[model samples]
Target chain A: MRNRFNEQLEQLNVELIKMGALCEEAISAATKAYVEGDRELGERARSLEQDIDHKERDIESQCMKLLLRQQPVAKDLRAVSAALRMISDMERIGDQAADIAEIARYMEKSAILRQVPMEEMALAAIKMVTDSVDSFVRGDLALAHSVIAQDDQVDSLFLSVREKLTALIAGGENGGLCLDLLMIAKYFERIGDHACNIAQWVEYAITGDYEDD
Target chain B: MRNRFNEQLEQLNVELIKMGALCEEAISAATKAYVEGDRELGERARSLEQDIDHKERDIESQCMKLLLRQQPVAKDLRAVSAALRMISDMERIGDQAADIAEIARYMEKSAILRQVPMEEMALAAIKMVTDSVDSFVRGDLALAHSVIAQDDQVDSLFLSVREKLTALIAGGENGGLCLDLLMIAKYFERIGDHACNIAQWVEYAITGDYEDD
Candidate 1:
């Protein structure tokens, strides 16, 4: 029974890694679509979001079953509870990625990506998300803290993006377009927040200490 | 033992309602600050948010104890899990309300509330939040659905606010101020979403069905 429980725990890790990969793919597709003005990539990201949703439900049920049958205690219980919390954050990351894609689909044909450092910001967000999941899969507290630290960079980038968009609007650029870009930047900032949340859950799973911040 | 569990469950319900009321007060205070340009109300809202946070941690520990000690199953298990999900949403509502208050603190002295129907929007969002918690406390599925339905109104109000702000920017109003108002509107919209999330969790607690939408 112990071995079986361990095997189930391993399976949970694998499923979470799969979900994280899908989230990364969704965000990358959305960012690519936004930068390149391609609606197809945005549509693909939306589909990926659906897959992430299904994965969340699947993992959620698995966690419930483990809790019911195994009645895990101590570190094992923490790991399962942390998994439960982490998936919610991961699912939000997927949703935010899909939101970014939806905004991309509605964007005007003219590229506004050049006006702001959105591409770099997107890259930073994606890396933070990837590293967060990596930290969870490996139970590496250092990696998790690094992912948490990266949120400040994403936040500062968002402020810079806002400043640039405000400058564009003041310079008589298209108000609608600048507003849309600002929304997209805001979505990226939210994605960073979700990533940070995941990292915090990972830390909790490993150390049994939920960092308050 | 069963009676004890029920009593504990009732305590949990009471705590959740307290948290929900705090959320409503925070949003109301923030909105009043925004409309009146009162920094004092904004500060009050911020402090209320801190109280909400402490309540979240307190209730979280209670739920964890209930889960571990009771080893609840079936409907009881569902109730605990639903509480787990609901508190996260409630906590987010508090955070978003505080975010609105922070924006109000920085808003220009000019009255932007007259230009948009933000007062109506804030009221609608607060109602949804109140009704969502009411549904949870009473297990009223119909009330929960009503809260869900109200989200569309809040969303439309956000779009209207965006339109008005866009027009203001186009007409040579302060772009920065308009953007800040837009941010505040977005925060209210987010508060509505969190309320909707709470209502969904309430449904799940009562019916074991997680509504997908």
Candidate 2:
């Protein structure tokens, strides 16, 4: 029974990594799509989001089955419950990625986006998502802590993006387009937040300390 | 054992309702503070958010204890898990309220906020929070569905707020203040999303269906 539980735990880890990879792919696709004004990529990102949703449900049932069958206690219970919490964050990351893609569909200001340079912001947010999941998979407490601290970087990037957009307006760029870019930047910041949340859960799962800021 | 579990579940309900009330109060206080430029109310809102955070931690451990002790399966398990999920959303609602308060602290434009009429948006989001919690308490599927649908109203209100802010900028209001107001509107929209999430968890608890949009 212990062997079987361990095997299932291993399976959960694999599934989580797959979900994380999908999230990374989704946001990357959406960001690239928006930056290049590629409608096909936007469409693909939305489909990736649906896959992420299905994975959330799939991983959720897996966790439930682990709980019911193993009746895990103590640290094992925390590990499984943390998986449950982590997936919720992953699901939201997917949603934010798709939301960015949705804006991309309507936004043809690839030049304006390049001018304000949200791609950097998107990359930073995506790195957080990737590192957070990596922290969970490797059980690296230091990585998790760094991921949490990285939120400041993403936030500062967002502020700079806003400043650039505002500067673009002062330079006679369209205010309307700046608003859309601002929304997109906000979505990326939210994705970073979700990543930070995943890292926090990873910390709780490992150290039994949950801190919210 | 079953009776004790039932009592604990009832206790959870009471705690959840209290947390919900705190969320409502926090948002209401923040909105009033922003609209009236009342620093005292903003301070009270921030304090209430701290209370909401404590309530979240308290309820989380309560759910963990119930799960660890009772080893509840099937519907009872679902109920406990759903409460766990619901508190996360409530915590986020508290955060959004405090974020609004933070914005309010720097904003002395009571007249401007009134001109944009975000009071209506705040009230709408607050109602969603109240009804979502009520649905959880009553297990009212219809009410949960209504709360989910009410997101559209909050969203349309956000669009109108955006439109008005744009017009205000066109009319020579500080573009910077409009941007801040826009952020405040987005935060309210996020509060609605969190409320929608809570209602969805309420629905899942009752119907075992989890839908994400």
Candidate 3:
């Protein structure tokens, strides 16, 4: 029974890494689609979202089953619950990517692009997501802490982009388009926040301390 | 030992409800401050936040003790874990209210209050928080479900306020004060989201299902 439980735990870790990879791919696809104004890529992102959702549900059930069957304690319990919480953040990350894709679709229909700062913001957000997940997989607390600090950079970029869009809208240039751009930036900012949340949860799994700022 | 466990659970519930009440009050105070441009009320909201934080820590420790000592299962486990989750959401709710108060302070400093739909949004958000916590106290899934549905309304209200503010800024009529107003509306919208989160967790406590939209 002990060996079986350990095997299941190992499998859970592998699946979570896979899910993290999917989340990263979705972020990249959505951002590339929006940045390049590719309708086909946007369409692909929409379909891929379904796959991400399925993976999230599957991973959740797997975690639940492990909890019920293994009745894990101490470090094992923390690791399992950490996986559960990380997946919630991952699912939100997927939603953020999908949200950006939907905005891409809208931009395609409008034939007007607000600015390229949106792409820069998306890139920064994706970096945060990638680094945080990597930290989780490697059990790197130092990397996780650094990722948390990097969130400020993402937030600053988001604020700057928002200010720029607001200024453009105030100037009465592509007002509606600028609003869509603002919303897209907002989505990326939230993606960064979710990444920060994952990093924080990872730290909690390691040290049993949770902090909110 | 069983009675002691029951007493701990009761204390947890009471602390959670107390935190909830404080969240509701701070939101109410923040809304009043926004509506009336009352800096004093905003100050009161900020002062109340520290108390909420203290209560959150107290409740969390109580929960950890319960988990370690009682080793609760099934329904009891759900209730204790649910309370822990609820406190996290409640703390976030307090943060949002404090955010609104900060916006109120900004408005006060700018001295350019045009009374942009902030009060309306605040009232709606405060209603959501109140109903969500009341549902949790009563364990009413119906109320929780309704709160979930009402979140869409909150989002729409937030959008409308944003649109109106953008229009105001575009027309250059509010002397750039519209941006501050927009931030306030966004704060209230986030408060509503936290309220919805609390309601969702309450439902999870009762049903063991996490519903996401």
Q: Which candidate is the best by TM-score?
A: 1
Off by over 4 Å in 1: none
Question: Residue B92 error for model 3, in Å?
Answer: 3.2
Interface RMSD of 2: 2.1
Best by lDDT: 1
Candidates ranked by DockQ:
1, 2, 3
| Candidate 3 lDDT tens digits, B150-182 | 888888988887677556656664423555566
DockQ of each: 0.58, 0.39, 0.24
Docking class of 1: medium
- B26: Cα error in model 1, Å: 1.6
- For model 2, state the Cα shift of residue B121 in Å: 0.6
User: What are the clashing pairs of model 2?
Assistant: none
Model 3 whole-model lDDT (C-alpha atoms): 0.78
lDDT of 1 by residue, B120-205 (tens): 89999999999999999889999999999999999999999999888888987777777788888899998999999999988988
The worst-scoring run of ten residues by lDDT in candidate 1 chain B lies at B104-113
- Candidate with the larger lDDT of 1 and 2: 1
What would the per-residue lDDT of candidate 2 be over residues B43-111, giving only the tens digit for each residue?
999999999999998998898778777878878888998998899889888888988999889865646
Find the 10 residues in a row with the least total lDDT in model 3 chain B. Answer: B107-116
Off by over 4 Å in 2: B108-110
Candidate topping DockQ: 1
Chain B alone vs. reference chain B, TM-score for every model: 0.98, 0.97, 0.93
- lDDT per residue (tens digit) for residues A1-213 in model 1: 889889999999999999999999999999999988788999999999999999999998898788777878889988898899888888888888998999889888765578689998999999999999999988899999999999999999999998888887888878877788888999999999999999998998888888856
